[model samples]
Target chain A: MALLDYFLRSKEKQVTTASKAKERLQIIVAHERNQRNKQPDYLPQLTEDLLAVLRKYIPVTENSLSVNVDKKDGDLNVLELNIELQEENSGK
Target chain B: MALLDYFLRSKEKQVTTASKAKERLQIIVAHERNQRNKQPDYLPQLTEDLLAVLRKYIPVTENSLSVNVDKKDGDLNVLELNIELQEENSGK
Candidate 1:
């Protein structure tokens, strides 16, 4: 809501980038936050399987999901996922 | 770009949220990508120091900068930071 918000603006008018990225990133963040105990190893397979399950109800695009592990934390392993879920209208 | 883009839209008119979030997240992503080998532990301190140094020339808000490590990736510690830089006009 202020002029200073656009310090990173670069003329790209993709309005939904932030919201979508936020949605995806939040999922990843939450997932990472929750799985700090088990240290899930089959993330790639897990994401692929989850994507398949999600596609049954909503259309999802390729590369719209990102799953990774970040070990910057000393003892905690973060399981992160960023997914773009298609609108229900786009589904059926 | 299309109608499906707003699947997560909830009538929040903050058009710059996604753009700004993306900008900040991209910086974090890039930072994490670069430091995969060293497994930096002083990221929060580093980001704080970086913010302090940046404040000399730019106006950055508290909580506008986020520094964290995501351990979702095995063997790679991702250093993540999201910073909102105030516009030059607002800075001066």
Candidate 2:
């Protein structure tokens, strides 16, 4: 019974340590995602900002444009910007 | 000159093929992200749906909760859900 109790306690400690490590990793990944999406040097944020400025004169809605940054090669990254214009609604 | 032209054309073709492959990979990754966030079997989506149903009875806004899934080990995945409550404003 004493041996079984020691084994169970060790297992609990291992599980706790694993959970802590996973939480740390999740925080790091979330930070990286935020930085990649919002940093000034990041291509996605730069393209979005540029589009926002251009839209002021172009008469385009914010939801009509979608911009994405994707990895091309192992290290190379590419940006793709797509804009869709809405059809004019006919009214009486 | 012909050999150089052939080499340049082949390089262009290789670049085109690589770009196509990258686009396919991007589509796959995006689909995986959507599936992982929305699929019924996925724990994150299940938890979110549960919370949404619960919030219908309670007072909660759409932006008050954040749910995420993370890989625990080589194969295991874990779900995390966090909810933040806003303080009431003091009106004059």
Scored by lDDT, the top model is 1
Q: Against the true structure, what is every candidate's RMSD?
A: 19.4, 25.3
CAPRI band for model 1: incorrect
Question: What are the per-residue Cα lDDT tens digits for candidate 2 across A30-78?
Answer: 0012112232334344344545543542344565555445442332344
lDDT of 2 by residue, B1-92 (tens): 22223323433454455322211101000001211223233434434444544353233456655555544332234343333433334384
Evaluate model 1 with DockQ and give the value.
Answer: 0.02
lDDT score, candidate 1, position B6: 26
Ten residues in a row with the worst lDDT in model 2 chain B?
B22-31
Q: Candidate 2, after superposition: displacement of residue A23 in Å?
A: 47
